[model samples]
Target: MSLRSSYYLPPQQLRAENLDSPLGLHTRNPQLSWKLRWNERGAAQATVRVVAAASCSALLNRDYLWDSGELRTDATEITYAGATLTSRQRVYWQVQVLDESNRITQWSEVTFFEMGLLTLEDWNSQATWLGNHGITVPLYRLSFHLDQVREDICTARLYSTGIGYYEPRLNGNKLGTQALAPEYTDYDKRIVYNTFDIEKQLCSGENVLGIILAGGYATRYQYGTPVFRAQLEILYHNGQQQLVDTASGPWLVSPGPWRDCDIFNGEWYDARLEQRGWDAPGFIAHEGIWQEVKPSNPCSSTDAPKGELVGTYAQTVEPPK
Candidate 1:
């Protein structure tokens, strides 16, 4: 990780940059009340708990606000949960101590933080699996890696078919399943998908994308079937689109008592295609057909060569939409 200083305050040494804020404050009331915010990876279903202690019990308050716009009155500890705050969100807190006359005595500085996001390692793992199985093949599939920027927004989306299932993570936090379906028959009916708007979960320079494809068969004969295929139509957000397809085989057939029967002998193939400089998108599949769409050119570069070991870690980055 790299560090960059945003602005330096004179009398009070404070620095603010990206999603991080390091500040120092001094007060004479023997109690310090302030709010801080930071980004968290994959905390979609958890709560943010804030605990504060002061030299005097009177310093604790019944009127402090802990990021979720709720009054902190029940106890010195405040918990924000059961809403957007529990999911991927940014929180800002404020502490105010009242004097003997019920007037505001002191105010603590404000800080910010983001929660529930993925990490670099998370993204790498997902990318590795996709790359190994030709899911990240350039022109064939829309190959993408995660990046961290100084933006105040983060989000993600997932889509699939055929009893699709997935475990999505942002930064390093697991965001839970985007889709869960048990039966898949037609191409359109078999699709499962999820999307997340996570602008609040983004960090300065660390982001991750973790995904699992759990709807494919485990037969030895179906080993080489391209169970997962994704294509990126446009590089930018405006024209960007994704096409995915998944399939399984031989679920009902069985071997005879005296002989081993190969119920599924044909191969299964999945492919995605994208032109480097052209807007023309392409795709091809050999399992079955859903709609009467134009078949992708088999000889096009979008298709990976058979038995070829595509190298991992080869990826390109584009600005987020």
Candidate 2:
């Protein structure tokens, strides 16, 4: 169930790799990287059939745009050769494979990825650095009112990123089971942001959006600083909208736990410095110390933000990492 924590990947399916419904996604072919377990009885991937479509439901029904019929290859990185992908174009795909023993496995679950702003104009929104550009760890928070919570709230995407690592919370609940935000990549070359669907995570009135970042590669082992940016867009069924973005919003960046957190030295947390409920709405400390965020590129020569992230996540099962 590594692909999806909720469901078991059917037998015969390769352990999916590089197919994590990626974000800040880019690539002409959008390669498919995956692997399978060996049964020790000569079990190996002999052939694979890939199906691609614009939607998930359409994929299972055989209503697809492209089909890679039983190609014999053990190559993990299978590039999408079906259609040209445009900016913000979302594609869903799944594959089934043939084993050496002529055993055909059930189709795997659908995996998807969306293209980022393909052109400069597509990036209508500006970038923002989450907090002070010199601190080691920074935790930002924003509280807003929903006015009216409707079940029709369909599209809710919190596109977020931070130098090193980040953990976003809505109403105190973590965005996903996955610990790491955006996948690991070379920060100098590219920065990955995560898109979360938070429709059910919202309430009728007051809500909180808190994000924390720690030095991952951003600091290069504490040799640099941490940075952050995020954009939230929500679409209501009645055509109404709400947005909470770091570029221009009520987000307040302030100091947080972790006296020192680095990739190599690890994090040092003093229980006495902890501020309970700091991430929840209506709770603010060191008020004057907080400051507004600004726009800055994580992959550019611009200075990075500072602060100790909450936790390392996988390595430490704590929040705000």
Among all candidates shown, the one with the greatest lDDT: 2
RMSD of each: 18.6, 7.0
Tens digit per residue, CA lDDT, model 1, 187-274: 2222212223434443454333333334333223243322332211112233333211211110111111111112244323332321
RMSD of 2: 7.0
TM-score of each: 0.24, 0.69
TM-score: model 1 vs. ground truth: 0.24
**lDDT score, residue 157, model 2?**
68
- Give the lowest summed-lDDT range of ten residues in model 2: 307-316
Residue range 1-321, candidate 2, lDDT tens digits:
112231213333322225456644546576675555544556667777788888988886768767888788876557778878786567888776666666665667677766655544443354455454455677677777774574767677666667678888887777866665645556655565566667788877777888887887666744356666666677887888766544655666766777887666788876775666767766764657676553442235356433221211112233465
Off by over 4 Å in 2: 1-17, 20-24, 33-47, 60-62, 70-77, 96-126, 133-136, 147-150, 177-186, 215-225, 238-241, 284-321
The TM-score, computed over Cα atoms with residue i paired to residue i, of candidate 2 is 0.69
Top TM-score prediction, candidate number: 2
